[model samples]
Target: MTCKALREGGAQVLAWDDNPDTRINAQSDGVALTDLDRADWSEVRALIVSPGVPLTHPEPHRLVRLAREKNVPVIGDIELFAQAMAALPAERRPSIVGITGTNGKSTTTALIGHILKKAGRDVRVGGNIGEAILGLSPPRAKTVFVIELSSYQLDLVQTLRCDIAIWLNLTPDHLDRHGDMAGYKAAKFRIFSNQTSEDAAIVGVDDDHSAGVMTRLKASQRQSVVAVSSGRSLGHGVYALGGKVFDALGRSPRAILDLKEAVSLPGAHNAQNIAAAYAACIRLGLLPEGIADAIRSFPGLAHRLELVGTHKGVRYVNDSKATNAEATAKALASYNHIYWIAGGRKKEGGIGALAPFFPRIEKAYLIGEAADEFAATLSGTVPNEVAGTLETALDLAARDAAAGARDTPVILLSPACASFDQFRDFEHRGDMFRTLVRARIGNA
Candidate 1:
């Protein structure tokens, strides 16, 4: 996508991929393929790399290091998009809203885009979500690009200053890619870079890392900070307390929306997402009542507490986006009498933090590499079994839930582990689960 877009934008594009198939595919698009290690430095404008390519910690990739020695700026597709926007006159440049964190970024990014598009704004949502940043339509007057940026993308972005930047809650993730929590935090905070006094910074204060970032941004006064929270009522900014969104950015706090009515926006985690989206839309001059109505109408993103189907007396939820303990915790907290199906490629700390929610699970069917380990964790505390695979896990869970006593048993696939072991990604895992559930439940 980056290569094709850059080509169409009239830049001389040279690209390479480690995968031969990918190289052949890009070559088919008229993109020139060259060995970066042997390419001439004089003719190269910049070294743009994918977010997966190592740019910093664990030592830079050879190509990245080589590019640095040759004085070529290394950047990602996002920086290119930024440069494209910058080329336009100030008034013509489209507004950009950047969102990042260990979780909730996708939901928040999509929610903001949905609200904008519903309000008739030309919104292009990409970056770490749907299409590549350059793959989206060119920026024009009133165009809003709602981007979900990963830490890796943020690391490669240098001059992409967002009109409004949102930093959601952060947790320990991609430790190998980032080195440690401190390094991870640094990458997440890069979303706030190059902002001026005119921009608005939306920071989620529910987590320590994000809260500390909010403090730093507050002290810097580089831009306006709209502190968001889901745990407690804030004296200022936006927050959700007692299941309602509160706008405390004024002299007195005012209730914005009753979250209970928003069927798709459930649980505290989603409340945080809603608060961030609400704060951002308001900053973009959206009316409060209109914003609330738009939020209520949001259909919610897939693979995050998505209700796939219902069977007999049971409901099936595919929360395959919960690829870590912190993320899974949110899903677990949102439901009860759960016939939980968990386990995949094991993550650090296991599912130990989820012990508090064990009582809510009627039974757990574990799968993939983490099955035995998770079974051991839940041995005496929670009724669990190593179902070995998602198919068996779902079959067993569904059978059990159908016979269970609960009025509405929920078979939840909120695996607190990465999906690389048994599937391509969280999306694939969720898709597989959705397909399996639909076969039995038939979309009821």
Candidate 2:
């Protein structure tokens, strides 16, 4: 999409990739046969690399080294889109709202986009949340672009200055791609690196790392920063105090809406997401009434905490997108008694960090490569068994939950690992779970 957008905007596009089966190759005007050994860069303006392209972390891709040697700038799709947006008329151009964090970025991005669309704004959501930003059609004059940016996307951005930049909360994630925690943070900070006084910066100051970043932003006297805290009352930001979303930027903090009233937005973490979205909408001139209505009507995204079906008194949740320990932790925290179906290709830390939440697991059915390690970790803490695959795990969890051993039993497929071990991606793994669940539990 980025290549297509660049081409449409009169920039000659030259796409190069080691993989010949890429969609971009079919759409591009010209394709270059690229490999680590190839060093031809005479005809290219800039090397527009994918965010998935490793630049500096886990050893930079050879192309990055080649670009550095040739003095040709290496940028990402977002950077190109930013430049394109600048070339268009100001009012005609789409307003961009960027959401970034370790967790809840997808939910936050989708929530904000849903609200704007409900309020009659043309909104297109893409970026790290699966949709390619450039592939999305140009929004109407009143359209708003809500993008969910990962640390990698933010790292490659040069001039992609968001009109409203939201920092949810930075946790230790993607360290392998960013070198270390500090390096990972540096990439996240890039979202606000180019913002000016005119732009709005919305941040969640609940976590210490994000709070530290907020402090630094304030010290620099950079831009208009709105801080949000779900933990306590923040003096100059939005907060969830006593189940109400409040804006604390004025002399007297004003109540936005009751947290319970926001139906689609649930959980303490979601409260933070709501607050940040509300703050950004308000800053962008959206009426409080419209924001409130949007929050009430928005249905949440799928495969996160999506309720698949209720069968035999057990509620099945498809949270296949919980591809990390932190994400699974949030899903686990949402439910009191969970028949957790977890395990896939293991990440660096394994499931060791989730030890604290073991008591909540009534019984964990493990699957894929990380099954043994996860079972070993939960040995004495929680009752667990290796189901070998997702199909077997689903059957075991459903049968166990149906036994009526515990009240309000919820069968949750919140794998705290990647899906590539047994499935193509998280969505495919989730679909398989849904298919198997529907086959077994739907009749019950």
Candidate 3:
């Protein structure tokens, strides 16, 4: 999409990918089949690398090394789009809201986009969430772009200053890509690295790492920072207190609406997501009443704590997007008693950090490549069985959850591992889970 957007902006675009099946290749003006070893690098203006393109961790891609050697500027799609948007007139240009964190980025981005659209604004949401940014039509006079940016995308951006910059919360994730914890945090911090005092910076002060990032941003003194908390009353930002959303910066942290009013938005993690979206909406000058209504009516995004259906008393949730341990931990925390279906191609650190939530699991049905390793980790801590595939896992989990003593029992497929082992991607895995759940539970 970035390449196509650049082409539409009247720049010559050349796209090269080792894989021929890439969607970007089809959208490009010209394709280069030449390998990094064989292609001449002197003619290119800038090399637009994918966020998935490794530049530092697990060894940099050959193309990146070639770019470095040839002195060609290596950049990502976000930077290119940023430059394109800057060339347009300020009023004609779209307002950008960039949301980043270890988790809940997609939900918050979708929520912000939903609220803006509900208030009758022209909005397009894509980037690290659903559609590619370039796939959407260019911004018009009233268009607002709600972008979900990953640390990788933020790392490549140079001039992408958002009107509203949000940092939901930071945890140890994508460490392999960023090299270390400091490097990972540094990438996330880049979301607000270029913002000035005129822009709004929303920070969630829930975890120590996020709090530390907020502290540094406060020290920088460039952008106006609004601190939100999930556990406490934030005196000058959006927060959840006594199940009601509140804007505390004004008189008395006034009540906006009760979270229960928003049926789709549940759990404490989602409350933080709601708070972030509300903060962004208020910063963008939307009325509180309108924003609250949008929050109440907006349907949640798929594959992240999504309620697929209820069979008997068991509620099946498809959270296959939780491909990392940290994300799965959040999903686990959302439910009190879960028949968890987890395991896949394991990342580093395994499920060790998820030990805190072990007691909540009624029984774990492991699947895919990481099954043995996950079962080993849960030994003595919780009961687990290796189900090998998602189908078996789902079958076992659903039956176990149905028979269990807890009311409102949950069958959660929140794999804390990547999906490459069994499926093409996370979405495919999530879709398959949802389909199987509906077929099994709906029939029963």
Candidate 4:
């Protein structure tokens, strides 16, 4: 996408990949593949590397180090888009809503985009979620870009200034890339860089780390801060308490929407996402009533708590986006009788933190590399079995859920670990689950 954008921008694009197959594919796609060893460094304007390519922690990528040695500016796609947006005239500059967090970033980004688009705004949503930032429609008058930025992309971006920057609760993620929590937090804080007092900064106060971030931003008093939460109430900002959505961003408090009526936006985690999105749309000049209506009509994202199908008295939810314990916790908390399928590449700290929600699980079917370890963790705590694969796990879970006494038994695939163990990625895993569930329960 970056290559295509560069070509469209009228630059002679030169591309190379570490993998020979990727290089061949790039060449096949009309990208100019260059042998870096023989290329002239003086002729290269800037090195636009992918966010996955390391820049600092665990030592920078060899190409990154080489670029530094050549005194070339190294940046990611977001930086390129930012530069392009900056080049536009002031009146034609599009507003940006940058969302960053360990979890729920994709959902929040999609929701904001959906709301803005439904309200008839020219909106383009892409960053770490759907499309590369540069691949989206170019900057124009009355346009808004709701981008989901990961820490890696944030680490590489410098000049991008968001009109509405949301720091949704931070957790320990991408530790290898950032080295530690402090480093990770520092990388995420870059999303707020270059913002003025006229802009708005929405911060989630649900977790201690994010609360601390909110504290610092408040002390600065440079940008308007909307401290959002799903668990508790604040003097000002947006939040949901006891299934009620509150709007105190304007301090003219009002109960906008009851979360009970919001069938798609389930769980407290989503509530936090809602609070942040509501604050952003309101700041962007959308009416409170309209924002709430759009949120209700939101079809929701693909893999995050998505109810793919329902079989004989059982509901199947595909939450493959729950790549860690923190994410899986949301899925577990959302339902009552959960026949949960969990396990993949077990993340650090395992599922120990999810002990509180064990009682909600009717039974757990584990799969992939972390199956045995997860089963051991669930031993004497929650009734669980090592089912070994998603197909088997879903089969067992659906059968057991259908026979269960509960009014609405839920077969949930909220793997609280990485998906690289048994599938290509989370999307592939979720897609397989949806396919299998549909196959098992035909026509329904």
Candidate 5:
């Protein structure tokens, strides 16, 4: 999309990929393919690389090295979009709401866009969620671009200067791409880099890392910072407490909305997401009443605690997007008497940290490469079975859930690991789970 956009904008794009198939696809898309090794260095203006391409890591991509050696700026698609926005007339460029966090970024971005759309405003959502930012319709007046940016994209952005920027909870993720936690935190901090006092900076204060970010931004006095939290009551800013959203933006803290009736938003994690979205919308001049209405009707993101189906009294949920321990923990906290399905390409800590939540699980059906590790962690703590494949696991879990006397037995697919071991990605794994659940429940 970036290449095509650049070409459409009249910039001569020279595209290259290490993979032959990718190069072939780019060539087929009307891109002017160039051999990076042999191309004249002086002719190149800048190198636009994918977010997955490392600038500094296990090793920098050869293209990155070449670009640096030639003193050409190396950037991602987001930066290109920023440049395009800058070229447009001030009145023509759209207002941007840039959101980044280890978790809840996508949900918060979608919620903000949904609220704006419900309010009859022109809004486009992309970036690290569905479509690429460059692929979205060109910025227009009153069009608010609510984008979920990854740390990788954030690192490459130089002048995005979003009208409103949100930093949700920060957890250890993509540490391999960035050298360490400090490097990852620095990348996230870049979301607030170019903001002025006129812009709003909404920061989540639940995690120490994010709280530190809020503290630093407040001290800098570069922008008006609004602290958001799911756990505690903030002296100012917005907070979610006891299943209700409170707006303490100015004078006294007042309840804006009650989330007890919101079926899609189930857990405390989502409460944090809702709080951030509400705060951001309010900052952008949205009325609390309208924002609350939009949130109430939100269908919720697919594969993130998505309720797939119900059979008898048992519920099947596809939380396949929870490809880490922390995410799985959130899903677990929302339900009791769980028929949990977990395992895949394990992350660093495996499922060791989730030991506390094991008591809630009625039984665990493990699959994929990390099954043994997860089983060992659950040994003696929770009853578990190694059901090698997803199909087998689903069958066993479904049967067990049906036999259980629990009032609400949830068949949850919150694998605390990546899906690359037995599936293409988390989405593919999730889709498969959703399909299986539908078929089983439909047959039942």
Candidate 6:
């Protein structure tokens, strides 16, 4: 898309990929193929690299180093879109809401866009979830762009400024890409950069890193900042506690919504998502009651604690998106008497960090490359079996959960590892899990 846009702007596009197959595909799509190694670096305007490509990790890509040497700005697709938006007339440009964090970013981005759409506003949502930023319709004055940004995308962004910026809680993730936790936090912090005093910033203060960000932002007073929390009541912000959502931005707290009946949104992580979404929309001038109404009716994102079906008195959930221990912890806490199916390509800390939630799992069915490691993590704490493959794990979990003593034994697939060991991606893994569950125990 970036290449197409650049070519459409009358620039002679030169594209290359390390993989010969990728180069062939690009050439077939009308992108002029060039051997970047032999191409003149001085003639290039800018090098638009994918977010996945390392700018400076174990070692920066050779092209990146060359681009740097030639003083060519290396950026990602998000940055390219931002530059395009900047070129547009100010009065005709759209307002943007940028969301970033280690978790809950997708949910919050979708929730904010959903609320705006329900309020009869012209809204387009993309960037890091459903579609690429450049693939969305051209921005108009009345149109609002709600974007979910990853840390990698954030690193390449410079001039982009969101009218409403939201930073949800952060945890250790993609450390190899960013180098360390501090570097990771710095990348997430870029969401608040380039903001003006007129703009608004909504931050989740539940985690230590996020709380520190809120404190620093408050101290600077550069933007209209609001602190949101799902665990406790704050003096002046949106908060959720005891299944009730509160608007505490006044002299007294006011209840706006209740999540006790929101089946799609379960657990405190979602509560934080709701609080952030509510605060952002309210700041953007949407009515509190309208926001609450939209949130109530909004169908949640799939593959994140998605309730597949209930069969034979057992419930099935597909949370394949939880590719880290922190995310898996949230899913584990949302249910009791859980028949957990976990394991995949291992992560840094493995499942050792989830030791606290072991008591809630009635039994665990492990699979993929991380099975042995996960089994060791749960050895004396939670009863576990190395099922080796997702197919076998799902079958075992379904049968065991059905025969369990608990009235509503929940069979959950919240693997705390990447799906690359056995599947293409998290979505593929989730689809297979859903298919298996439906075949084994007919969908409700």
TM-scores for every predicted model: 0.97, 0.94, 0.94, 0.98, 0.98, 0.98
lDDT by residue (1-444, candidate 1, tens digit) is 888777777888777888899888877877789877777789898999999998776879999998998899999999988888888998999999999989999999999999998888999999999998888888878899999999999988889999999998889998888889988889888888889999999989998777889889999989999999998988889999998999998899999999897798788999999999999999999999889999999999899999997778788999999999999999999988999999999899999999888889999999999999999999999999899999999999988997888988899999999999989999999999999999877644
**lDDT by candidate, in order shown:** 0.91, 0.85, 0.87, 0.91, 0.90, 0.90
Instruction: For candidate 6, write residues 1-444 as lDDT tens digits.
Output: 888888777888788899889888898988888888899887898888988899887679999999999999999889988888878888988899999989999999999999999998999999989989988988767789999999999999988889999999989999999899998999889888889998999999999999999999999888998999989999999999988999998799999998875678999999999999999898888998899899998888889999998887888899999999999999998999999999999899998888888889999999999998889878888988999988899888877887787977999999999999999999999999988988876543
Clashes of 6: 0
lDDT of 4 by residue, 213-311 (tens): 998998999898888999888789998998899998664777999998778989999999999999999999999999999999999899999999876
Tell me which residue pairs clash in candidate 4.
none
- Candidate 3 lDDT at 381 equals 91
TM-score of 2: 0.94
**In terms of TM-score, how similar is model 6 to the real structure?**
0.98
Worst 10-residue stretch by lDDT in candidate 2?
A: 27-36
lDDT, candidate 3, equals 0.87
Stronger candidate by lDDT (2 vs 6): 6
Q: Name the runs in model 6 displaced over 4 angstroms.
A: none
Query: Which digits, one per residue and each the tens of the lDDT, describe model 5 over residues 103-150?
Result: 888889888988999999899999999999989987668789999999
Candidate 4 Cα lDDT to native = 0.91
Please list the residue runs of candidate 2 whose C-alpha ends up more than 4 Å from where it truly belongs after superposition: 23-40
